[model samples]
Target chain A: MHSSTFNFERPIPAQPWRGVAVLVIVIILFAAAAWEVRCRAVGYGPTLNDTEDLWAQARRRVEPGSVVIVGDSRAWFDSDLDELERGLGSRPVQLAQPGSCAYPVLEDLANDENFHGTIICSIVPRMFFAPGGPLVENARKAVKRYHTQTLAQRASHRLAVPLEEHVAFLKERDLTTEALLKELPIPNRPGALVPPRPPPYFQSVDRERRARMTESCANPGRLQTRVKTGWSRLFTPPPPPRYIPKEAFEQRIAQAIEARFRDTTAAVEKLRRRGGKVVFVRFPVSGELKAFEDQSTPRTGIWDRLIRDSAAPGIYFEDFPELASFTCPEWSHLSAGDSVEFTRRLVPHLRTALGM
Target chain B: MLGFFKYGNFLLENFQWVLARGGITYKPPHLDVFLPIGISFYTFHSLSYTLDIYRGVMGPTRSLRDFALAVSFFPQLVAGPIVRAGDFLPQLEAPPKPQNDRFLWGLVLMTLGLFEKVVLADTMLAGSADSVFGYAGPLIALDSWLGVIAFAGQIFFDFAGYSTCAIGAALCLGFHLKDNFRFPYAAIGFSDFWRRRHISLSTFLRDYLYIPLGGNRSGAARAMINLIIVMFIGGLWHGAAWTFVVWGLLHGSYLVIERLLKAFVRPTTWTESLGVKLLIGLATYAAVCLAWVFFRASDFTVATRLLRGMFGGHAQADAILSTREILQIGIVTLGMFIVQWSLRETSLEAAVARLPRSVVTAAWAFMAGALILTQGNSNAFIYFQF
Candidate 1:
């Protein structure tokens, strides 16, 4: 069929390379110019996107004595980057992503030869203890991508980093196709038109939370926190048990955590051998969320065991009343002002551990 | 390092199972690894090039530039029509003289490829197929069949879409890539289906592997063994898993059954009656879909569960897919069947080229708009695995 169909007698062009080159140049030029115009329209410059490439670029810029903060969204929001930098001497490099677990980033740093300074890891009890759990797959994915990425990714990341730093339009938090589809008004079928509910507006925390959304997906603004607190006040009653104990499920969960801890311990000890020590910080979680965390994985069972096994010194916030009483607006994270205080309060503990 | 990382995920998982059987548990950190983007296609391309040279069907290319250019030819590099020496190398001898019309036609073909991938495959079919194959809960027969059918459509469009892009892109560069697909959904039988679908790779196997195994020149039992062996190798080439092996064996069984039946089944059943032809076509599609369950599933258990679900051997009729999703899948799949059937006698480009310019323009615009609206995560072509 192939031999029958091919037009073998067709004359070759004099210089197909010229045509290919021209097309390539035109498409690239057009895309670059169009992106600039679009970014400008959005009141942003065409900045490099902050994909793994950009994140890896940031990771590559690490130097000895530069504090690398790695953990989840609590690490992302609860620690004021500026405050941490002021309290410590150097400007901190932020590696933590919102809604991500800590161990992946810790694992990454442990593997890296260049990064010899302290990694102030914010420990979310459930995520650190349950490596294979559903909630923290993002961190796992990020780590996997980093391990498997190509050197060509570095060039692409280098190209995109400027755009990311300048243009808000290129942020990871921007509306994705899946997100837009979820919010779409389209009904699942005909006849029964699913009338879309109006936006919750001032009545809910969503709009306010959304307004505070930055590239990092960290909502740390005063207005956002106030709105969240107001919303939280309306529902002061704690959520019912987030996880029910099933024997097989719990066994797998524990095994998953223990296995990761063992792997992480070897890696961390290697880092220690390389003249760097890893310090864990239990970020403040308040009210119902803290209660849920306490019930789900208490200090003795999960966190303490992890610290002991990994041989990493951990600062549980409840041990220090100065850091502990700062109210978390969402029961998960400290607010904008509270974060600054929290950062100021927490840096000394980290510095002491780092032998600063 | 790349090889280790690429196959590491699969190897580590399998090894963990091996280790577990020995009463030892292992969870290597490297187990959490990403696959090399297009190792399967690359391996096949290399295999085709080497085997043809070994068979003396083609001479070894002493020219490194020509060899590199053919293998790494950008258009078909990642996902391919699975080219051999005769497929692409000779075209690189002289400077290309790509005509503008051919170039424009190439652009149009790229648009068509994008439409098939984005609008039909990813947007419409992927969700439903994923729902069915990935469904942990019980599923009834109807949804299960729809899911499998959607998958058949999905893989076809995804791979065909990529192949079309490769062909068109090569044409633009004044190189000819032979057509990979030829209205495969409209094939008359198993042999006909293989001839139509992924034509290059199938033909490559026929010429190199099948012929080397004595083809049909040998007696019946030996020929059957040869066919099964070729098919088994072909299946394993797609992946490293047992499911792929099963998928290959199933198709091999189908071809064997077809050859055996061809001896006894009269010509009138296939040639003269449209009802019989349609019935046969449907039965072929059903069998193909059954095989695809193994092709698509993670393991034999998942494949068996889905097959059982398709036969109404499930405890629950859970509604995972929405009615709207079902409708969208149905329309796209029907559209594909109708189009492929109509174009069985003629090529897609040839058919389109006959239409009025305005009609073509309108069609392109409609497809482009639909694609823009429904564009998903630009998933790599499905055949990139093999």
Candidate 2:
């Protein structure tokens, strides 16, 4: 059907325009290459230069049978690898970054042939109830990577897809890239360690109110005062609603987490056929972080349901309300000392949970 | 009408808030300035329809389907040639029978439009125009002029490319649409330019605004005032900002002046002299760029800074143009201008027909190849916001 018609127009006379088009194409190709090389030489690709390269190198040389902290930013900052090794006799690799949401981690584990032992994931309450929640980002990134690979392969072969398909693929790639890029990274460092710059004018009043509330929440007698202050704070709208309340937001997050857990567990069961243990741990959080979760008023039984429904056994969940009691000079993040204390308490629980 | 209501309600609410907060001055949000998706294009089409109907040149569409299809045809849904209902409804009623040759030609046209947009406009924008326009610090006088010229070329190609895509898409769906542009940069005067560029939109204004406001018939001053009113409103139709309004006023003022000048100093030659052509083009181009300052900038402060820099406020010229960017800008502008100029005497369909069959076949192949190779990273059509 494709080769039915041949244009027998004067034996296809040598067209000067074709030569011009060829010349133009060649020049464009050379120019593009030069521009790319120049951009790379000047380090333009990633915002944080050499960050990915560092990860790639770290991935290659990690010692076998070492503890692995596999999660997002909380895992990156909260888990003290040296302290864990000192206490548990194994140094852990912190295989996580700021914006590494749950699904990618699960996909990575599913694809890994050598992944064994425990995998700790941090499931923050706010993450579950955030607009443009994690599921969208996961689906977007997966589709983007798929489309990019497809286009790159087609280009290499000097082949083209149909215009409609090409447009569809490009649109998907764009939507995915946009969503992923806009996904704000959870700040990893402790506030005291980072020492955030003075609040902008828009944030000054809100910051003061939050600080006062935190200070009040620390005192038992001032709990009533803090509650009054929180209600009064709502009377005066602070820096846009920090979190908008929508059932869809929470549902999206829950679905995303459940999907990740189910997929990861199924993959792990396949590996278990060859005799490998798979233990899933929900990482510990600071007291203030736990307080945020308490405020969230999570739909009762969703977390328990997810854990119970998982295909794999050895699922350990940590709900450390005491972590919030520590004087970690941040709304959510734990101090280094608090992180060490939490890990010391968590390691034994994980060991028992994994039957190690 | 619903678009107007939505925009008006949004603006009024924002304006009221700004007024209520007496002590603190407030800038309107970005959403305030952006036109609803298809407002500018569709409103122009609506205005054209009413005018055509009133003029007894075309009847009102008999069925809502015909009128709706005429207005909301997906291909030209965002940007447009402002397809008149008179010309469009017949085609919608009895959609053209799709022939293989027509389909192939439509494909070729669509490919060409994509090439013009993605390869030419997108690359030039990413490489040079964006940076040059965005330059905050000092710029040489020559650099400013160059920037303006580049912008003129960019807007022309961008808009014309969009129109081509709309028309080509319509053709592919077995419908005929009117041409929006006709090598407008080659025009010698404001009137000539209007005649050639966005023909439907200009005609709409002529029929609805200018004529209603005592167009040309009233004495010179009143006529000028009428012209200014039309253009200013036209500009506001593009955006909800003072900049767009000012841009429109500037063009309207120029048209008035150009008309008066033509009346007093009539050229003896049928063709305008090369010097006159160059002078008019340069003058008009510069005027357009000055107006674009308002179009591009966030506020008057940024526009002022850009204008000052353009006029050699700092006199920095060391890194104005990179060699590669210059080549790209040169090739795209020269290639497009030459093709447009050559096709001035012929319809695009006729021009394609004139080519040898092999050349025609190869041109389609080449266009397809180009579209595939450089289909950029899916930037939204600029007019979509408007």
Candidate 3:
């Protein structure tokens, strides 16, 4: 038989507890205040981090016949919600995520039997046709969060909005401990396969998941240069992994891309069968990033194949002089001013594509 | 029902494998089951109560409300210190008088826990561990070792953080929960490791399974078998995967080997020296890390690949971890070792008591500040799955 009766009280360290508490609070407050001021001085502002919760919030707003935007950051950045609302007769639900594949969101909508509305999917070919990696993972994560978010998580996100809206240093993507640590100037081994750090925050996101390029990023400056420089590295495809044979890896990638094309065509067809409309749009890219992306994932490749396979109406930025004229300040996304104009000009083409 | 959720697919897959070996092909219908969060912990909480009552250690509580409260004490309900019903029921017997000191101390502990989780585990180690583990290419030995080491630190902080937070939260509610971890990385032997690490699970297994199976009383061989059986069950308790089972079996094997060594080797002044203990502790940590490869890996393929890389099988492989990641792992692991070594013989409360009030305040402030910087981006507690 077990011996002892259960009686255990945790020992609370005897100290001047009140003094310690007060002092700790004071120090934390001072440190936080100093950090906030420093962040603001360095061009950081009170902007909500585009979290999975925020993505889920936007996803939940999608009604049966709602005009939904599903794609990568181009769709997120360039499309003005206000302009789209005015043009499309309904405000499109912004489901597009930065650095994420559009396929998952497209697939999710296809699977949603109730959703028979129009989908304006932005085509960043590399991201759109990504087989598996962070690009696909990010979109899948947002979609998963929409499905699996708990009441506690929903509540936490709701509470965080006010604080995130007011606090400049609450930038989860950049100013977090992990992000700051990544900013440290440490050299890697020559052959190290480390991924490049993501570009720092250059845009502000609103409650509706609308992202607008900040003035610091939009104008020709340090932030703009830094953001532009980071893109070519990110856009260029990673080298084939050493573990797999080169031919085998290439063949696997080819197969995956083919599968994606077939799957996308089927998804678009499914939506169309249910009285839904789908249009693929290739958003404008600029500078070195555009060159790298064009070289890697050319229009003759995934984009043309997708439009042909899906038989969805396609809008290529380069095909139209008006849309192609506006330059992306940072080479990847549109500035706040240009985006509104871009969205305004693009609305008529969208109307024609969807036959609205 | 809980077991079905956790083990349904695992069992089916294994069964299919077994059938294939017998030259029969079978395709079982897949069961899509959602694993209830903290299913393992709460099951133990309820199981311990029934067993305790069955064993005449404690009487069955008449009040269903009190029993329900003990079973689902929110703080420890999901990821636990696995608070026993016998311990908790008695605490609930008397209403606790809330004290300012205890509540503030609890808040301090909670801050420390969050700091460990957010800043240390998620920020410093998880990326490196994840990058190395998730890489599709062969990795150099340095990357392999760093990856495992990163995982070791990450799991410790992640789990220990949750336990500390649970204990602190319970304390805030005027209840006491026992410590789950006690500088486990400083343990000098497998026996010592179990004694310090996951104390609740270890004790629960010892009391319910090991002793009942003729623990050390019968004979050396029988005791060894019992230890392995208990650890096998312990490993299975963690997850449905064979990797977890392997992890458990590795620990069980380590325990048996230690027992055999103990039978031959005698303790002396030289053996008990600080340097020797430290060396042994490092070896114990290394072996534990090897086992953790199995625990953390997705499958045997990943485990074997990592193990081979660690042993320099991939001589010409590319280095996957960046210099920053390597430094982060090195600094965090070293800091952890120092803290664990210093506090091996004491409790956190006792250690804090010895510090100057100013020093305590500064440490608290530093942890809180770092936590604020983290902005709560850390993943959920590792043990919540278990």
Candidate 4:
């Protein structure tokens, strides 16, 4: 019936809508079941994606004098929080992110005047000295989330955790339609400037942001090869933009790198002045990837300069045979088993470095 | 308040530039303003009420609570269909009656909207568009055109998706918000495009701004001037940027030209033919896409560069998009065009009504499944900026 008054009522289509709804629900349930099965068969397991919200959740747990792990993926994957808690007599908050620069997190902690805490910073020269772009942006994004996370985001993360713990198909980074789309084997035109794709899901993350190398990825197989190759693509510096002159671009990069050095020193000094301790640890790197890193961003250039400039104690893995004896399966990160052993061997050094 | 938040810094920067040009140094303290989400939308929502009351179209409501609800309805609060206070207030007078059909349909619409936004806009198109637009150097023609096409599709889905969600959510609560989009890509003329896209804003401008300025009551020349003036304001309504102003002005010019052409070239059999209509429809879309360059670009420099590339000005430039990205853009754009054109002549409800029950169930299921596959990774709605 039409209303003559201003109150308009839209026409409902004459169909069995309730029946349709039931059918839709049934179909969705079936589809979800199939998808979960397929996802499991393809080797995806129920694990947390290291999202900004998850990082923020972990960041909120930081107390005034807590031990915190901060840096790139090496810190994220290699630092066993349980072992560190046992050795250092306090658990460390894992604030490190994969493919992220440590500078932003370090700067954030230094600025948090109340936090005169211990920082065990991982130093991969290529990642640590990154002045800007995705490496720095990633850390900055997590810090920003920590500062600006809304109630809804926090609630959503809480709800998502339970679902993520049981669902193999809920891999946000790899199983999402966008990520899957990128996996398509389509060639680019000659001279096309496409960015390299990130490595696939090869690590499992916990609620506390601790990452471990998946058994499949840790083994010498296709997954290992894929992860290894992906690293080389990721670590190699992209060519300068065509719009900018090569000399100018190089000069700008050099200036940015120099700024990073000064900033890192200032941050370290600031933290130390506030009675906080910092230990820069160079985790293991091996094989061709180690050779590549050694050639591209040698320890002598950035690492030695950082230790000298900041006057902070550093633990170089290569300096100790106990640490250097462990080989990274993918030439970058330790296997899940080795990471435990690695952490066990390294905790005494961490204790010594922090004067514990 | 909306003006101060959205345009304060823009005004200050422009004033500084003007002062510099006049050989006088003037420095204004930058106002660090955070724009309240949906300020523009709510401003318009409240403004419509005041104007409606002022013009005696409707008497002011006695209930302050109802008026407040009308102004700040949660479904359309942040990004909107720009629901007019008059349309919304009457529905709140009575308590809503729950209907299972209405609720289910609303869920269907919400699912479809999310699919458009997350799966299509974010996953398929955003990356290529971002790569193309964010590229510092010039791009080849294919990449340039594909980028623009991707953006055209992305914006349509992003905005229309929000509007659809808003409308569907409102329906779920027994409120009837009018449609914001109606197959705008299939529009045959600039005026038609305006009619079909962001229908509320267009109607608002027509009633409040255009008619207030005497609309077409004056001579043709005066009417043309009025059109430009209305469009200039419309452009400025989008943002404080001159690029947005130019985008508005380009549409203004297109409307003026369409008017001029209609006056001189009487419709003949050839012009009225289906083929000619299709051709004109395509031309209208292309022109609209061209205008979108200014709308989407950060500045005139980007708009000009893209335009140059679009017209074969960058033959020796780099090709940035991959084959997969190219195919994604092409396929999505084509599919959008087909769906829009097909549905141009009828309402979505009518089209859905004609479909069999099984088909409807499957389509709904597919959209829902696809949405789940997206893992809720979507950017904020595009219109939330405006």
Candidate 5:
């Protein structure tokens, strides 16, 4: 509608360096400095995220006599693979996928000819009580999506792992210019921001390192108050008591147990037939999370049924005093410090259960 | 493109269900999303190029590389403003023009577009719309309206956001693409709405489809029939679904009724009044939104249920969304409309150019902040699936 914004009289830079040379460099420097400050303030060092690549790296290092660990995030993150390996005099291969259903991985390991070593799977009640098929569909979806991506996509992801490990700025995908624009409090609309989606990491990271990064990231801004933490706060004034109908509760619980039993047992039998031992480990969960798991899937109700029907040796953490004594900072996954200790404490019990 | 393959399969699936096995009844073994993401759009882009060349409106290109570049221009290659060859091809030969003003303007635009996409469309609107649309059971009145209204905003932002990004990216490279959208929500009539929304596609359909079908020059009856026919095919062009056809029919009916009403209902003086314009604009938007129900729903049953809820069929159903979620839709949708209406007669860059330096910087800062606050794994633009 008006004059051209471009000033054609001015000579342009040559190809491949036409624009934003200085600007891009300046922005990068400024951002790097900002992130350096934030990381230093939060006391987090250069640490790679716990990702699929790291998991693969760990898996590749598994020796023939090594015990293969498989389950979900709880099993993988709550124990130090190195510590467990040292404690048991055997290495550990972590095939434990976060958000994965345990049975499928179990089934895969059972069918493997090369892996005749012991298996340890931690069963969180939610996955065990869920009526769906093994939630290992993520592995399939990831594979499909992976195939569709270009070499550039792969390279970019590979580049991001190191960048994320080093720079807090790269770690914050939501802190982009585009994302920050929408955070302005202009209204006639909702001011609420959608929670950021985690970047898909193809490589494995140090579990301890990632947990620490998460801790750093969750730090509040100046205006934001710190979240209250206490044993009493876990119960609160307590959440409003919810009522589930007896018929619905029992029906769901029955269906869930049946599915878990049918799937887990099949996996265990196949593993046993291959001269490999299968053992279930209940990971340390405490506070409100433990309460909910206990109620939704009582040890007697679901865990006992699976162990009984599968004929696999089980270790309920509650049954052993030391295993249950470890503090779970998040009440789901153990902190980096405690995970090593927890692994050390459980090694003898795990050895006994595997009849090693 | 695999889009045609998917469309053919979709038609066959729906055909058997609606027509009671009138032909071969085939369903794939498993649910697979095999359809190419932006096949429909690229097809139209190429289609427009070919038509222009065939009609002697644009010269045939001798350079295959330039032609390919035009067709596969990455900015709008997938979901597009459907840039025409006459506008974009010549610019390809020109060397890159680097000016701080143009570059900064492009960055500003890109930021705005991304904000519209991930924040407003995906985060705020999509969740609410999905809750109602994907529900197996019935939705109540408030829920249905909220769902559809949110959709009206979502579809607008999603596609417009894409076009804005394309335009901005091209702008940064010193290639100008005509703006694809205007203040579509503020349009005072069906025809006005068409003029504003997806300007390239609408014009192409008008020139290639409507005019060839004898347009308004043919008598009233033939013209009306032509309009309906063009729109019906236009709907089918989006996808092979019957729902799309119904959406077209709804729009066609609105246009016809508006045509009939134009002669008698309006006092010429009243038409100039801002209040009257606002009233008409709102009514037109509501009409467009109702048509969107058919466009968005999976099938006739869902559409029927949605319509029933809209007209007060179900008032007592349990709420599917929280207040915060609804608040999100309202705020984002309102913010979009306010911005659009405010800058109705000017471009975003132009409007910002007129602003004081401090205000412009602050606005850019706010945009950046907003984008960070509302991140999501946004699905591809809604139009890309077409």
Candidate 6:
């Protein structure tokens, strides 16, 4: 009975489709990862942009003998590097963006291996109160999520390690190129032009009037101001413009500047162990703008306190009220004539401050 | 149990105001939290399984490993079609051999889900949904209607995408799961729609609550009372909020009225015609929209403000129906309805399998690419709160 038929039968094998599909998915993921790595290697990521490029270029190009003039927009547009060189016996390199403060400039100097020269950080209280400063918040959050070693921690570990432990420590943690890249002073593109050639140099009142006329015609708001020509137009007047009180506007601006300054300081300190000096400066303001600053007494008091407390062995210059007569064309910034004069005046003081 | 304590601790600490307002006795520092991701959904599934076993409808699982695997199965772990133990366990016991056709089809289904979530839902939300929902003043009738339609589409696509992905993943592992939705918007009545939408959860509620509370045994009044109780609990299940409770109660009331009307006023041939069906569908959809205001809003106050706006409490009617909003709503609504209608007969897996291999592969690649491009900022699922 057991030997009946004695026929051999084969069982169908299970298909490997699931394994194949998984393989395909793995390949796709690998391809994506490879592409992302390639992109990053070429300096293509969300954080790498024109600003970073400019900073990187400047960091590499600047030499030990270079005199660097550093501040916010005032330092960029207010002080002429050529005039400083002509006045002082050395050429000054302008390292400034429109709304940058002292901390970034200091961090740049400390981080750059090639930069071994004098740094003049312009401390503009108004610049300290500029907007958009929570730059490191997301980076911090990402670091926290990914458990990446911070620069401070890495530096501490490296400093603590003996010569024999160096290779092992280096093997344990990947060096952050971002940290190195951020040591450079990134330049921002020039901001929108402020209309009305800013009340031309105080000496030339008639020149100011001509500039105002040109501005009035060119500016949208000034152009919108209608002449009382027709009865119909007078009867059907346009709605009053939505107005923000000057005080409120200044308060918001001040808050933004303070926040940015604090954030930039934190970022600088994070990168400071790499051996960078930090500075904060206040650029000169015109007499009319000085009046506005004086009117904002509380903010001014706070600004003074912030400057005094932020002593990082760097310059905290208030070129305002002192240099107001020499350079300022408008409420805050300098005219071309004023910029040249101000640069000439700043050279000796900067050299003395930087110990060059 | 640890997850329960963690959630309990969180609630005790964060929502003392809610308890204080309700005059509920509770104390913080007496709670703990061991938050497992998607603890809410998993707990509900566990409860459903335990209750079913208790009722003698399903036997208790002998193996803890099987139970744990079923509960924590990654595809449906975060969000789900709420797979039942009875339906899911048998497949695990005797795993089917994976077929090439099935694997390809699963890929197709996954892609379709991604398309619904990223392309349709995310784009629609970025356009009109955010603006309309966030509008402060009373909505014009047209704007309110558009917002409701947009929301309906959003919720369907979002949940359906999750469900399809879950099913596809399960299929890949040689298991079959139930469909969670079946063209719910196309349903003629509230009852029909409920049957189609979140079917597993709805069935669980019916079996656990309605039947235990004597259901329709006593009278219409008792039945109404039972419905209200069930719905209130359902709402509470969604979140620790009065708004959700109220939303549930409102839906319960609607269902009761519908049932009562059905018993008392039998429809004639004409009344049961296409026009009548259309009217009923629109009325049911409108009611669902009203409830969603409460569901989506942070609290009852916000929901009331939104309702008032919808009824033209503040703004002129013309101000509500902006051309851009209408166009955005129209596009989303069309896309949602098309997908829903197409996936009605066959399961998403089956439908994809029917397509030519080349088309299926291309469709999947395109969907995967789109998902990557337009990924939502949110990593958490909407239903994770429940």
Q: Model 2 off-target regions past 4 Å?
A: A1-356, B2-6, B13-37, B50-57, B315-321
lDDT string for model 5 (A1-356, tens) is 11112222212222222233344445445645775687456544545544444444455555555687777767866767677768777667776766666765666666666777788888876664445532456433333343355465456556756676666433333344333334445432232222222222222245332232144222343211121132223222222112345677667657766776787788788778778888899998877768866775688877887789989899988889989897555556666667778888888998788786
Residue lDDT tens for model 3, A1-356: 22338889999998898999898888888888999999999999998989999999999999999999999999999999999999999999999999999999999999999999999999998889899999999999999999999999999999999999999999988888888888888788887777887899989999999999999999999999998888878877888887788999999999999999999999999999999999999998998888888887778877887888899999999999999998998998899999999999999999999997
Give per-model TM-scores: 0.74, 0.54, 0.97, 0.97, 0.79, 0.59
Docking class of 1: incorrect
Residues A1-356 of candidate 1 have per-residue lDDT tens digits of 11212135322223343444455445545554665577456434333333454455556556876778788667766767677778778777776765566777787788777767877787776666554433357776666656676676656555555544554334332323333344455456332212222111111011111111232213445534544454333323222122333576567666887787787788789888888878888888877767767876688987788788878888899999999988765566665567778889998987787777
Provide the fnat value for model 6, as a fraction from 0 to 1: 0.02
For residues B1-386, what per-residue lDDT tens digits would candidate 6 score against the true structure? 73353346545655776887899866666543335676756776788668767776677777787788767777887677776666665555555785665665565567777677666655554335555576544555556667766777777777887787777777666666777777787666677778888886777778878988998898888988998898887777776667788988887888888898899879899878977876887688778888888877776665776677677674433233444445656876776556655665555445644666456444555566555434213323466556
Candidate 5: give the TM-score of chain A: 0.69
Cα distance off (Å), candidate 3, residue A153: 1.4
Pull out the clashing pairs in model 2. A287-A323, A287-A324, A288-A324
Name every residue pair that clashes in candidate 4. Answer: none
Model 5 chain B: ten consecutive residues of lowest lDDT: B369-378
Residue-by-residue lDDT tens digits, candidate 5, B300-336:
9999988888888864443465566677778877887
How does candidate 2 score on lDDT?
A: 0.55
Query: How many Å off is the CA of B312 in candidate 5?
Result: 3.9
Residue B44, candidate 5: alpha-carbon lDDT = 71
Q: Score residue B61 of candidate 3 by CA lDDT.
A: 84
Model 4 has an lDDT value of: 0.89
Instruction: Place model 3 in a CAPRI quality band.
Output: medium
Lowest summed-lDDT stretch of 10 residues in model 6 chain B?
A: B372-381
Q: Between 5 and 6, whose lDDT is larger?
A: 5
Q: Which candidate has the highest lDDT of all?
A: 3
Give the lDDT of residue B297 in candidate 5: 97
Fraction of the true interface contacts (Cα pairs closer than 8 Å across chains) found in each model: 0.05, 0.00, 0.75, 0.62, 0.01, 0.02
Return the lDDT, model 2, position A165.
Answer: 24
Model 6 regions more than 4 Å off: A1-356, B1-34, B126-148, B315-326, B339-366, B375-379
Order of models, best lDDT first = 3, 4, 1, 5, 6, 2
Computed on C-alpha atoms, the DockQ of candidate 5 is: 0.13
Candidates ranked by DockQ, best first? 3, 4, 5, 1, 6, 2
Best by DockQ: 3
